[model samples]
Target: LAAGCRTERATSVCLLRVFSVCVCHPEEKKSVPSDEPFRVVFRNFQRTLARPVLLGQGEAGAARGTLQVSRHQDHPEVCVYVDASSTLPFVPPKTCAFLGPLFPPLFSPIASFLPSESHGVVLILDGIIQCTERDEFAYQEMISFLPLCCHPNPQRVLIVGGGDDGVAREVAKHPAVLEVHQVEIDERVVELSKQYLPFMACGFESPKLKLTIGDGFEYMKQHEGAFDVIITDSSDPIGPAESLFRESYFELVKRALKPNGIICSQGGSFWLDAGHVRETLDYCRKHFPRVTYGLAAVPSYPTGQIGFFIASLNPETEFREPARQFEDAEIDQLGLRYYTTDVHRAAFTLPRFAAKALNP
Candidate 1:
């Protein structure tokens, strides 16, 4: 409201560029305590487009004023709707825009009630990247790499639901990985990241990589026991991703890997989504012989914390070693901004509360 103006349907830079925004009107909701700011949202329900500038957030309401910015929208100035009674609170219109073209009603109001961190950015420490710190690549790295390294030789790896390509890029680093099959349900996420996040999306260009645009569940059902290591890098348990956290899906994952096969998947935040994390761990324990919960610090993710579950049939194999290629001098030569061995080792370290919630 400061310098940026909102329009009804006309597209604007900040509106059409990203997905959603979180604005707090603390006093609007009676349930909110006096000390808490009222959380509101401005959602953009349109096609995902890349632009130089995404959002222009500022202080509008004067009473205990709070200013927050969502990730980014691709369209021009558009209507910013409000919905206060939500688990995550604010959801922009085109959050799952990639799925929109295929399933038009995927973002219905009922579906909007669930929590999803993928469509928009969670505001942390004044809009810095620390939002993902809680769930770092450290924990994700352990869950992803440890299993792949345990195998005598891992050549074919399959990753389901890792649209961000972060997990794909990490898996491709293993020299034993001669080929990678990354199956994602949404293609816009891949295409958008290709424009927005270059480093993370670099995995899409690897010669060893084969990208598939389809349902990962169906993909797994068809390719039973075909992978040395299979990783599920999916969003939190909400919308279409909830099935990824279920026992049925883990059952499929169990069958998707070779005898010595291993599987790893994001279990949500150990702090905010601790209950969900425990449920996932419990489900994984039922399907796999070895189930371990690991933590990471991704600055962009909420609460500076994230968890991953590793399921393997091998009980004799150690769980902490890095893959050989990860240690190779030549492979190590690549300029990495986030992942490291010490970081990888430390990612498994969880706070007492988190440990108790997931393991207890």
Candidate 2:
């Protein structure tokens, strides 16, 4: 039995013959015959380990368990949470190819993309979550669908930030959308997302989509009254996105939107940062006549929720009921994981505490 290990860049790739060495659960030890020719592949990641590696399958095709790796060296070294008693056939999990690191932790979010082990593909910019693949549906579906659905015919849409996630794809899902122009600050996020997170990268391939590698603030400053719907998928109300939550930015957003336009933005969490939500809405409400808030359950977000600050030029436009309704069948056809007509309306019906904090 022979073994070889190679280190490249920030990753370690170990190749071990079936007979000699393998990492797995200690209790379920299965001795490997010295003659088998199968080779097992193991990879270690620096910066972050975005995918899980499953192991311990014998010739009998029986499953043993799974292994999860993390970039946080301070955390547990090995944690296997998969059911061990179930005797199911061996099935390889979805293979998430490691593209590279996600944003530069200490600096800007200009790096590679990698799928998270538990939380789908994850983007951590400045140590804050930009998006979590598994839970992003809640934010993507709501942020993209809410304002677009509110408009009678949202043909031209503008997406600010959220280059690495599926926000553009969600906007393009609407049949009425003629063009989707996305202005993302970091091109590396888009490039890496397209390579590692294919599910979120679908929007980049759309014929109606035009991606602009630039700043959303500058993009809005240059364009005015051109969009029917504007969705701000910016990160937390800090760092590069701190200005996005300011009244001056909304002033630009108001100018960029059509007369009857609507805008929706990532408005922080009510339970975690109610003050941030209130302050953002205060800024948005000054530019638009009608303004409100909405929320979606995303476990990755603080307090198991993510909020959206919604505003409309027309006071008659209610953020509750959508202008365009979709049947369950149509939703299925569009492959929408979340954001239904009911969910859109119900998302605004917040708890009393949130209602007082945001609305008051």
Candidate 3:
């Protein structure tokens, strides 16, 4: 398929074919090998449908391929079809296959509804699973509350690249947060989340939220010392989010934060890439006086886990211990599913191997 190709869905099966030109941007053209293979995922099987329909025209349509649908005995509702001769380089393990088209040249956002055992629905961008409804709270709560609770007073908050709005939802739950400003480069992710994943998208409806669709780096440059807390809910260090993990981005974040400000970002999973995690922390330490790495169990993410890089401008700031602890009743009142004062402390306590790799 081309870089930004769209797949059309039928009653039960989705038709995805390669094209010479990008669907989202017609001005760009991508060349594909004739024998290149693409995988197809079929889920929510209600009834048998017609065979896969081939799309596109010319050599792109006539590309040589074979489709084989394999169903597991445990999960009869889901089936995966792949071209036997080729390997799927993009699809992640345990993630539902996407049927939507890629959006924008920089980011390919795909949303898929999975079987009940896996999750309800997921938002995937650039072949990485961003959020699943079942376990999204685990990530959203930790990323938002970790920094908010670490800060003594986090009134004005800024969220960078949280297009799904999950971070906004969790940030708004903090009573100390008076205003929430979010900047997302891609508007399609927000619109798609609102349409397919309202549970997270509802965060956009919060009265305290003031969203600005723009580049977070540029946005932060213009708003120096404006926010008490800044959370960067970005993807891995690749594609459109690659710059988010750089030293320059941390410099911008430091400039945008107040004197005592605290910030947290979506640090890559150590299990997947420890060096990248350490590199990100090094960048953070250069800008902030105190920096800590926290982990969360997000089943849908790679390795069934994800980590966050939390830093504070105050030299004495303790990220492991929450500055503001919420009572059990207060936690219930805030509709918190995964975060607690104790959990906040435990998240920063890394395992032996992780501590050695990250701290060293």
Instruction: Find the 10 residues in a row with the least total lDDT in model 1.
Output: 47-56
Model 3 misplaced stretches (Cα beyond 4 Å): 1-99, 109-118
lDDT of 2 by residue, 167-273 (tens): 89888889999999999887867777777678788778889899998878888888888999999987666456788888998999999999899999887776545
* Cα lDDT over the full model 1: 0.55
Q: Which 10 successive residues of model 3 have the least lDDT summed?
A: 53-62
Per-residue lDDT tens digits of candidate 3, residues 18-99?
3211112112232223232343233422211221221111111122343322211233232333342344323233433444
Clashing pairs in 3: none
Candidate number with the higher TM-score (2 or 3): 3
- Per-residue lDDT, model 1, residue 161, is 73
TM-score of each: 0.65, 0.70, 0.73
Ranking by TM-score: 3, 2, 1
Report the lDDT of model 1 for residue 262: 80
Error (Å) of candidate 3 at residue 262 is: 0.7
lDDT of 1 by residue, 5-94 (tens): 233532222332222333323244322122212321224221111111112121111111233232233322332232223323333433
Candidates arranged by lDDT, highest first: 3, 2, 1
* Candidate achieving the largest TM-score: 3
Q: How accurate locally is residue 138 in candidate 3, as Cα lDDT from 0 to 100?
A: 98
